[model samples]
Target: MNKKVMSIAAMVAGFGPSAYSLADSQHDEAIERGQAHYLLFCANCHGVDADGNGPLVELLKVTPTNLTTLRSSGSEATVAERVLQAVDGRHAVGESAERKMPVFSDNLEISTVIEIAAYLDSIQK
Candidate 1:
């Protein structure tokens, strides 16, 4: 079994004979991977805090969107879906003469994009 399942089983076996807790191991793993990817590819423009105040923000013509408030922005789509679209270059949050954010569709794997979305979703306020 995977480490996640093993750990959860250990907790159940050790904590109580017939007691157990639910955990989405895949989601947790995705978030971890997403955070690492975000730090590597997005932090320069989106900030480590994801507040759109990264070191390279001033250099761009358009400011990056603050990711923490995305879910509360009243969009019909779920935060994860919106993030997926944005990263895939299918949805532009702030369209100008030219989009400042590069299209990551070709650069990142689909699973990687989903993981990034998962991470973004976890941080939404």
Candidate 2:
């Protein structure tokens, strides 16, 4: 087929919508994966709603930061970096020198941590 005809066919095939659908699919996948990680690793402290009111809160010396307001409450970049480090078994963003949160660096992949962060950021209140 001629180049012009091929281009026209591509456009007529809902290529534009297909591309958009793919992007939406990817976003949805990311959110799902992220939510899984959050539920497994974070919900215990951050709560299912990321509200810092997890069931385990009464047992802890320090309160968990509300994950949903990480950006509105403070710097988004700072929050993201802190989350990345916390998940990687490094510094705890808001923890004391005697950190209490479980480190998942060995258990979770970097990509998974990133997905969780993206999900958390997207749900910011």
Candidate 3:
């Protein structure tokens, strides 16, 4: 093939759907891991649908944040970064000096935190 033809073909190949597929794979994987962890740790408070209406709501002094609205809630940070901070307990809700959200920074791996964040981001409205 001519140089121009070869270059065009290369460009087209580089822009193919495989790139999107790879990204989608990684995104799906993260979401899967995140969902599992959320179910195990957060579902008791955050709810399976992450609507802040978990079964334990009545037992807690503070209501869990409705995670479905995080993206549209006018927060400056992206959903993932916000979740990371929250999991680390750096983003407390009220000034009560006692945070209801348990800090997972000590027990969970950072990668696990990121995966949980990824899952939360996927469910945003």
Using TM-score, give the best candidate's number: 3
lDDT of 3 at 23: 74
Candidate 1, residues 1-125: lDDT per residue as tens digits?
23532443343233221322444665577779989999998889999999999999989888888988987988766566566566656664544445557888778876676667767877888
lDDT of 2: 0.67
Residue-wise C-alpha lDDT for candidate 2, range 1-125, written one tens digit per residue: 23532343333232223555657776667768889989988898889999999988998887887888776764534444556666655553444456666788778776687678667756868
Ranking by lDDT: 3, 1, 2
Whole-model Cα lDDT of every candidate shown, in order: 0.70, 0.67, 0.73
Question: Which regions of candidate 2 are displaced past 4 Å?
Answer: 1-22, 76-79, 92-98
Question: Could you report the Cα RMSD, in angstroms, for every candidate shown?
Answer: 9.8, 12.0, 11.7
Cα TM-score of candidate 1? 0.75
Structural similarity to truth (TM-score) of each candidate = 0.75, 0.70, 0.77
How far is 16's C-alpha from truth in model 1 (Å)? 27
Which pairs, if any, clash in model 3? none
